[model samples]
Target chain A: MTATMPQAAVGASLSPAAVARIRADFPILQERPHGKPLIFLDSAASSQKPVQVIEAMDDYYRRYHANIHRGIYHISELATEAYEEARSAIARFIGSPCSAECIFVRNATEGINLVAYSWGRSNVRAGDVILLTEMEHHSNLVPWQMLAQEKGARLRFVPVTADGRLDMNRLDTLLDGARLFAFTAVSNTLGTINPVRELCLRARAAGAVSVVDACQAVPRMPVDVTQWQCDFAAFSSHKMLGPTGIGVLWGRKDLLDAMPPFLTGGGMINVVRYDRTTFADVPARFEAGTPAIAEAVGLGAAVAYLTAVGMERVARYEHELAALALEKLRGIGQVVVYGPGIEHRTGVISITVGDIHAHDLASILDREGICVRAGHHCNQPLMEKLGVPATTRASFYLYNTPDEIDALIAGLEKAKRIFKLT
Target chain B: MRPADDLSGMDELYRDFILDHYRNPRNAGTLEAPDASCEDLNPLCGDRIRMDVKLHDGIIEDIRFQGRGCAISQASASLLTETVKGKTVAEVAALGKDDVLANLGIPISAARLKCALLGLSVLKRALKL
Candidate 1:
C-alpha cells in the first residue's frame, strides 16, 4: 500500500485557474429553476453527476449492453470486463488492498444489511455487544438493532458531545464489551467528521472489528482504508458524484473470506447440487443475481472525475463553503445551527428557526427555487436525543460556490419574513 | 399560483388557525390529575407529544399536554384540547377527520393529517371510548 498519507495534511488547494474549468465539467449545474440560477445544496442527500459519468454510462449502454460473466459472445465478454473494471476502480479509489475486496451492492443500506445478516448473524452471540454512535444514519443503526434483537446481543451507543463530535471518552467506556464498533466517518445530519483513525485504533485495542460508514465522508474528503485501518467500510455512489443503485462495501480480505455469502442466487454460486451448493469467492459470494452493471460503470467514471480534480481540492473547497455557510447562518439570529464546533466537519449543516417548524421553512424555501431537506434525515433517534421533531438541512458539494451561500442567506431571510419568524 | 385564499394545495393546509394555535398553544403544560396518560410518537418523522386527559365521572373535566414537536402537531394538540375541554369521552371518541379539518380551518396533506390526528387517536385508544 502507498505510504500512509499524513492524516491531517492539508494538500494543495484548488488554484483559481482550476475552479472555472472544473465547474464546466458538470453540465447540470447550468440549469435554472423558477427563472433563477440553480443553487444545489442538497448533495448530502445525493450528489449531482458530471458529464463524464453520464457519458460513460451512455457509452456502455449504446455500445455493449450485455449480461456479464455467463455469455460466450463478444459483447458479453466486453460487458463482464467493464463491470469487473468498475470493481477495480472502486478498489483503487478507496485504497483497498485488493480488487476482490470491493463488493458492489444496492446501496449502503443493503451493504450494511449484508454484514448484519451474513457476518453478524453467524458471529454475534447472545452475550455479545455491538457499539454504535448516537448520530448514525438509519442504515447503520437499524441493522445492528435488528441483529441485537434476534441474537440477544446488546446494542450500546457512543454519545455525541455537545459540539456534535463523538465523545471518544464515552467510546473508550463502551469499547470494553463490544465485539463490533460500527461508526460513521461523517455524521449526515450534524456534518461532524469523526476521528475515524483514532477510533479504529481504540476498537483494535478493544478486540472489536471496526466498520466505518463513509457514505458522507468519502464524498467530501479523501478516504484511505490502509491509513484509517478499519476492518470494513461502506459508502454509496449516489452521495459521491456517482449513480444510484451502486454502492461499495470494502472489507479486510481475511474477514471477507470468513463471512458467509449474504444473498443466495445464480450469480454468486460456484457449483449447485440438490443437497449442497458451493458459493463463489469473497465478492461474488455476496453479489446475488444480476448486478447493477451500468451504475457501476457510472460510479467508476465518477471516481475517475473526483481523482482528476483531487480529493484534497474537493475537501478544501467544501470546508471553505461550510465555513461560509456557517457564518451566513449564524448571522440570522433566529436560526440555530447544529454541529458547529468540529473544524473538519463536512459541508452539511442542519438548522432550525426559533419557533417556525422545519416543514414550513422548507416549503417556503422550495418556492424560491432553493432545495433543502426538511425532516429527520433518517436519523430519528438523533432527533429524539436533540429534543426536536426535525431540522432543515442544506448540504453543499463541489459545485457549490460562495454566491450560492449568499443566496441561501438571502432566501432564509425571505423565509423568516414569509413565516413571520421575525 | 392560486390566490392565498384558494388553499388549493399545501397552502390550504397551513391555515392561519393552525399557525395561530401553533404560536399561542392552549393547554401547553402537563395535566397531573389524569387517570391515564400515554406518550405517543410518529417515529418516522419524530413528532412526539404526551396527552393528559383529566377524566371525572366519565367526562373530560380538563385536558392539557406537554411535549415538543412540529407546528402541525403542537397546533393539533392545542385544537384538540380546546375541542375536547368539556366534552364526554364518547363525544371525543366520535371526533373524526371532518372535525379535525374544521378545527384546523384548512385541509392538511395526507402525510401531515396523521400528525394532526395523533393526539386524538391515541386519546381515544387510551379511554377505550
Candidate 2:
C-alpha cells in the first residue's frame, strides 16, 4: 500500500518549512478572524480542508457530476469509477484487506449505529454482555446503550484510571462472557491512546467481537486495521482534512457479508421483486442512497494528501506539538490539564484554568481568534468521571504550529486576568 | 502577541459585577423545607441550576439557588436569586428572557443565551411547581 502512494520527501520530523508549505494548502489559514490570525486548534472537532480536497470536490461537481452504479452514460461511468476508486484509496489508507469491506456512511456515528442495528441485532441475544469503556464518545456509548436496552443485553465498562489511562487490570473480568467489545482507539476528551491491538486480541480470545472507534486515531496517527485485527473500525472524513457528510466503516469481510443491510432503498438492491427484494453485497448493501459522491472524491484527495505527507510524520509532529503545549500549560499554575501524560497521549489537550468556566475561557480565546472547543465535547460520561462540568479542548493537527499553542497559552492568561484570577 | 484591544469586548462580557456575582454568589445555598423547588440543566455545558423558593400567600418569601457551571450561568443565577427574592410568584413568573438579558447589561451572544437564561428557566419552573 505504501508503494502505491506517491510519497513526498518527508523528513524524520515535519520541518518548519514542510509545515509552512502544508499550511499554505489550506486557504482558511489565511483568513483573519476578529482581525486576528485564525489559529485553528479544533481539528479533533472537524479539520479544515486543504485546497487539494476542495478542488477535488469542485472538479467532480463541475466536470463529472452524475449518479453512480445505474447510469450507462460516460459521466456516470466516470463518477462511479471515481467513487469506487476513492473507496479503494481509503481502504488502502487504513490497511483493510479489501475495498469491499469499507462502507460509506454520513459519519462515524452512523457507522456505529449501522453495526448496532444490523450486526448487533443478530449476534447479541438477551442477557449477553456488551463491553465498552467509560471514555467512549456519545457516538460509541449511546448506540450500545440503545442496543442493550432493545435486546436486553448488559453493558459493561472498562474504567478509566485516575491519570486518564484505561484500567486494563479489570479487562479480563469485563471481557469474560462478553458478546462484543467496542472502544475508542483514542480518547477524544482525554487524548489517551488505548492499546488497540491488545484489546482486540483479548476480545477475540474472550469470543467477543471487537469494534474500534477510530475517529480520533485515524486522523492523528498511522492506523492499520489489519494490524489491529479488530472486527470493525469507524472514522469520519471531516476530522481528517476531508469534507463532511462522509465517513468509513471498515469491517471484516465475513462479518460485513453476514450482516443484513442497514438501510434499504435504490442502489443497494440486487433484485427487486413485487413483494420482496434481495440486497446488494457488502459495501453496496450498506450504501442505500445516492451516497456522498463529491464528498467521497474529496476524501480520496485527503487520503492522497495525507499519504504524500505521511502519517508517521504527522503523528511525530503532532506529538511534539502536544508536548510543547503540555509544557507551557504546566507553567500556568491555574491551568489543570486533563488526560494522561504526554507519553501516553496525543495532541488533544483538555484543560480548565482556575475556576474559570470552559465556556467563558473559550469566549475569551475566541476573541483572540484562537479556536478551541469548550463544553462536554460529547463525552458527558467522561466529564462526570473527571468531576468537571466541561473542559476547553485544544487539539493539534499537521498544519498547526507551536506559535499557535503559545498564543493559546497567552489567551488563557488573558482570560485569567479578565476574571481577576491573577 | 496581539494587543489586548481584542479583549476589550471580553471586559464588557465579564464585567466586574458579573464576576463578583460569580465569585461570591448571594443566596448561594439551598433552603430547608422549601415550598417549591425545581432543577434544570443547560445541556450544552452541563451547567445545572436548582431553584428553591419559600412561597407564602402566592408570594416568594425567600429564594435561593445552587448551581455549578460557567460564569454567565452562575452569575446569572446569583443575579436572578437577588431579583426574585421577596417578589410575588406571579411577578417572577412574568419575567421573560428579555428581563434576564437586560439584567445582565451586556449583550449576550446566541451561544451563551442558554447560560444567561438558565436561572430564569429554573426559577419559572420552581414557581410553577
Best-fitting candidate, scored by DockQ:
2
lDDT of 2 by residue, B7-101 (tens): 66898899999999999999989999999899999777889999889989988899889999999999998998888888887788789989999
TM-score of decoy 1: 0.87
Model 1 ranges with Cα > 4 A deviation: A1-36, A340-342, A419-422, B1-17, B29-39, B50-67, B80-129
Instruction: Tell me each candidate's RMSD, in Å, in order.
Output: 5.0, 3.9
Candidate 2 interface RMSD (Å): 2.5
Interface root-mean-square deviation, each candidate: 4.4, 2.5
Among these predicted structures, which one has the highest TM-score?
A: 2
- Give TM-scores for every candidate, taking all chains together and pairing residue i with residue i: 0.87, 0.96
Give the TM-score, chain B only, in order for the candidates: 0.84, 0.93
- Please write out the lDDT profile of model 2 over residues A141-191, one tens digit for every residue: 999999999999999999999999999999999999999999999999999
Distance (Å) between predicted and true CA of A10, model 2?
14
